[model samples]
Each structure stands twice: as C-alpha cells, then as structure tokens.
Target: MPHADTLTVVHHDDTKTRYTDVRYQLIRDGIRIWSREGEHSLTDILMTHAYRRREQKH
Candidate 1:
C-alpha cells in the first residue's frame, strides 16, 4: 500500500518576484517512493501522480 501527499511552497527572488510551487508525493513504508514537482497547477500534479501510481502497480 502507498500514501499520497501534496504540498505548496513559495520562493522569493532577488527582484522581489514570488513564486508558488506545487509538489506531489507517493510514500511507502516511511520512505518516498515517487514524486512529481514543478510550477504546474495543483490539478495537473495530482492527476499525474495518480497515473504514475497505477502504472507502477502492474
């Protein structure tokens, strides 16, 4: 079995530009089994993570 988690992050640049980041992770047995991260939308990150999980089960 696996567990799923999502996180939102922030970064500030020298030019005072702020960025929001989305990250998704699949963990098993207290360790991270898979991860997807980028500046993408939350919906995209979740969908991609789900697809990858299904593929790995076969």
Candidate 2:
C-alpha cells in the first residue's frame, strides 16, 4: 500500500469555467512518498486517504 506521503494533484473547474488545480501532499511517518496529477473530486481524495488507512491497518 502507498503511504499518505504521496502527493496528489487534483484539477477542477468552477461553475464559471475557471480551472483550479489543487495539490495535496499525503503525510505518513512525517514523510512524502509519491505524487499524481489529474482531475479529481473532493470525495475522491477523501476516499483515497480512507482506503490507504484501511489498508495500513491490515
């Protein structure tokens, strides 16, 4: 499983058609692992962390 230290880039557009790119750095053991870039929803990011945590628990 990947650690939260991974950074994920999420691109999105507002109702006005303005593009917004958000970069999220995953924190695990006080370090960063990897990164990704793409258009993602807030729910997607949250679910990613949730899934990572669950995986780590096993």
For model 2, residues 6-53, the per-residue Cα lDDT tens digits are 333332322121222333444542222233555333332222321223
Q: TM-score for all predictions?
A: 0.17, 0.17
Prediction 2 global C-alpha lDDT: 0.32
Q: What's the TM for model 1?
A: 0.17
* Runs off by more than 4 Å, candidate 1: 1-4, 14-58
In candidate 2, stretches whose alpha carbon ends up further than 4 angstroms from where it belongs are: 1-20, 29-46, 49-58
RMSD (CA, Å), candidate 1 to true, equals 12.0
Candidate 1, residues 1-58, lDDT tens digits: the string is: 4333433222222122222232334333122223343323222122122221234665
